[model samples]
Target: MESVKIQNRDMAWHIAANIQFPPNFDAAMTWATIIAVHPFGSCKEQTSGNVYGKALAEQGFVVIAYDASFQGESGGEPRWIEDPTQRVEDISHVIDYAVTLPYVDADRIGVIGICGGGGYVLNATLTEKRIKAVVAITPVNIGRLFREGFSNYDPLGALAAMAAQRTKEARGGELQVNELLPASPGAAKVAGLTERDVFEATDYYKTPRGQQPGGWTRMLFSHAQNTLGWDAFAFAEILMTQPMMVVIGQKVGAFGAYRDGMEIYGRSTASKDRQLVSLEDWSHYDLYDKPEPVDLALEKLAPFFKKHLNEATGQ
Candidate 1:
């Protein structure tokens, strides 16, 4: 239940991480580093990253759950901005801090990313060998999620918005948006009354269980520029080289997305260590903090880390 604030290199931003360590853990005996990424608009603590980090901490790993830049307590201007490149660098910086900690086993580091954070982890894993394992819960391929269902790779709309927002700030500033539609504009809106993309997001952010007021913000116009295919499907070739564990709940309709990854894993001539696990009657958000899937995922995952720690350490 300890937390620390860290400043990243490149003057990117200062990130606040909530860390948890196992009772009487030693740096030399089975130490682990976990980096949990939150969904695009959510902060580190308000989402599943912290929830699962706590669970893994109980199992003996040192979990570091952090807010992505420009969102949450992390520093960045034009709040709620999305930049795939900067966030990936942010991941590297977090890993940098983890390695320097006496209690963290630099060689056995892993990452846990929930929702959109899942996509960032994938991007980092493909490029950053420092990442040994990945546990993506109820994940969203941020890039594909913003592909507007692949309507097109067009970027003009997004660029224009960024310009407009910058101009407005230069002239005068005000809160742009309080919340965005849960589903993309192209996403099939749920059949019902007042709500964003889904009832759960609206309920989650508006209610105490998932709500963290003053920490949420609206999307930057076409913010998709940073996410739309933000190296999503493109990274599969590289991802096949790492050990990846995907946890998908039956609801949230993400098995297909899970399969998307499994198919890639299947093609991987490099990594046969990949695994796909499903929880019955469980939806995407169920794994966030709910009992069933969270317990189920960790039951299987903690052991995976235990066995993989050796490979991570080359022992």
Candidate 2:
């Protein structure tokens, strides 16, 4: 449970990170680094990633959990804005730091993304070579979210609306802010999430269980949204040469999450190492520490990292 400050290039932005390893870790396993990303607008401390990281550390690896850019202790302006591009960059930056640790094998570094961060790590793996393995838990393909709503309508329309808003802000040096999430559960949210989303998010964000005031994000970013058309990989097209692990829950309709993951899994050239684990009664939010659902994902996650980190994999 050791925490430290990791400074980013801009604004001397320093992310608060925790790295934990087993009490009697063996050096023979090679140094393994786990860079964990939390859901949008949430900090590293308030995530399923933290608990999961500790779990992995108990198996003998240094797990690095940190605040995503502009959230928690991390630095940025008009905070809590979703910037898909920057999010990927943040993943690379964390790996950059991971390799610097003396115990880090450099060749054995991997990543884990929770919620939106899951989607971010999926995209991040495409260009980064240092990262050898990846895990996306209940990832959100923001591109799809903006192009079509829960009903699978034109989610991109929402992103366009935000883009238009940014255009106005760019020229005028001013902006009209909007709510971070939907007004409330309604007929609009595609996943029938209006009610459940408001209700649960209120519990996580408003209550001490996961509350952190600075964790709130803006309705839009100052940059482009990772929509399918312009995305590095549309929901289905991005390919990777690295080993990736995809986990999706089954409690609800998970078409989009699994759709995006399978799309990548099919395109990835990596052989004999890709895995897709499905939980029987899991939902998208369940991977974030929902009681019954997390058990399934958690059950598989530790062993996945342990097998790769401790066993003979990359040599």
Candidate 3:
């Protein structure tokens, strides 16, 4: 694994990434590359991205796991803001950088998106034809998840609150930060989060199991402002043409229990190949780092990318 910095198109921010090469990798060989996108408010070093990068690298694919601009070690203003459009562009910028490497086969580029990143990957591939295959694990359409409540509850009040907050910010009110997770294990229970929602996530992000200095629980209030009308699957019925695979947890309890993935699968009409894999007895968070589910996801990912990318590039 190697840490490197690449400039975004406007030269406004330096994207930080960890590039992993397969064991005994040879610079003379043109290897397939995979961009592993991290979840919201997370970085390149976060558990899901790191685990996926390493796992794919071991299987002879060059993997690049990167911090989205404005978060982690990457450069940008209004730190911790989550803009879905910018997040989709971030994958393209990383691809621009990846193709410059001598050993990378540009035509064989693929991507794996974890959590909200999955939604962005789907959005990115709409016009980024260089990506030959895509894998979405326990995907969430962040914008929809925020605009419509996870359980499909109305978000009129929430949208009104965000509009008011934005006005306050424009008037020089201090930016408000919203927590992505409960403040404590006890707080999760008090918030009425089931054991499935809190257990794995709390252990990974809030505890020592996978916590990192760059990981944070809060995001700028502007994130909500940006996501109000964004839809990750806006053009899935027409524009999403790449071969796609979606991995979801069968026992997930959050966000209507895998409804997002189902909608994505249903709407993707142009994919040459599309599949939905449900991991039995797994919750949404379980796909992040739990060995059983992560391994199962990778097992499905390796062959999908290998077959599609190889077919595209004749590798």
TM-score of each: 0.83, 0.81, 0.93
Regions more than 4 Å wrong, model 1: 27-30, 149-175, 181-197, 214-217, 222-224, 254-269, 312-315
Candidates in order have lDDT scores of 0.67, 0.67, 0.83
Return whichever of 2 and 3 wins on TM-score. 3
- Of 1 and 2, the candidate ahead on TM-score is 1
Worst-scoring 10-residue span by lDDT in model 1: 184-193
- Per residue, candidate 1 scores C-alpha lDDT tens digits across 98-126 of 88788777888888777667767766777
Residue 34, candidate 1: Cα error in Å is 1.2
Clash totals in order = 5, 15, 0
Local error of candidate 1 at residue 192 (angstroms): 2.3
Model 3 pairs whose backbones collide: none
Q: By descending TM-score, how would the candidates be arranged?
A: 3, 1, 2
128: Cα error in model 2, Å: 1.2
- Which runs in model 3 stand beyond 4 Å of their true positions? 150-154, 190-192
